[model samples]
Target: MVGGAILRKLEKRQAGGEDLTLVTRTSTELDLTDQTAVRSFMQSERPDQVILAAAKVGGIHANNSYPA
Candidate 1:
């Protein structure tokens, strides 16, 4: 939830030609547990900074289980 809000703010900023490459993926699309897929994604994208927004703080235990 927090990450998504931040992403929206960044998107608005990028509209002013910040040239930021904001890469984001949901848990379903990019499983953090899979090392091979993560390596492939990082090599292909080569992000300068990685935002590790893997936690949902205000959530129930059942809804906040990270695959790690």
Candidate 2:
């Protein structure tokens, strides 16, 4: 939900002629837990900025069973 909101705001900025590029990927496309993959992606993209809005979501029961 939060990620969606941030993306929308960025999209609005881009539409308003902010002179920025927005690059995004789904969890299936890029797993944040893999250090090697992340490094490779960063090296290839070399983005001027990054926004990490990804997260692992769970319910109350799951949280209780496995706390992080």
Candidate 3:
């Protein structure tokens, strides 16, 4: 939901005639935890901005294993 909200804000900015380049990659296409792949992507695309909104949430059982 946060990611979608951010995308909507960016789209609004673009609609206002700002020169922006938007790029997106699915989980199948990119492994966000992979360092080498990320570095290569940055070198090639050379983007002005980047947003990382990756989230991994486990169920209640998993949450109970952690401390307060």
Highest TM-score model number: 2
Candidate 1 residue pairs in clash (backbone atoms < 3 Å): none
**Model 2, residue 53: C-alpha shift (Å):** 1.3
lDDT of 1 by residue, 1-68 (tens): 77888888899999988989889888899999999999999999999999786874645664556533
Weakest lDDT window of 10 consecutive positions for candidate 2? 53-62
User: Which lDDT value does model 2 have at 33?
Assistant: 93
Which window of ten consecutive residues has the lowest lDDT sum in model 3? Answer: 59-68
In candidate 1, how many Å is residue 15 off? 1.1
Per-residue lDDT tens digits for candidate 3, residues 2-54, read 78788889889988998877888877788888999989988888988899887
Off by over 4 Å in 3: 57-68
Whole-model lDDT per candidate:
0.84, 0.91, 0.82
- Using lDDT as the measure, what is the rank order of every candidate, best first? 2, 1, 3
Candidate 2 is scored at a TM of 0.81
**Model 3 deviation from the true structure expressed as Cα RMSD, one decimal place:** 2.8
Candidate 2 local lDDT, residue 56: 68
Using lDDT, give the best candidate's number.
Answer: 2
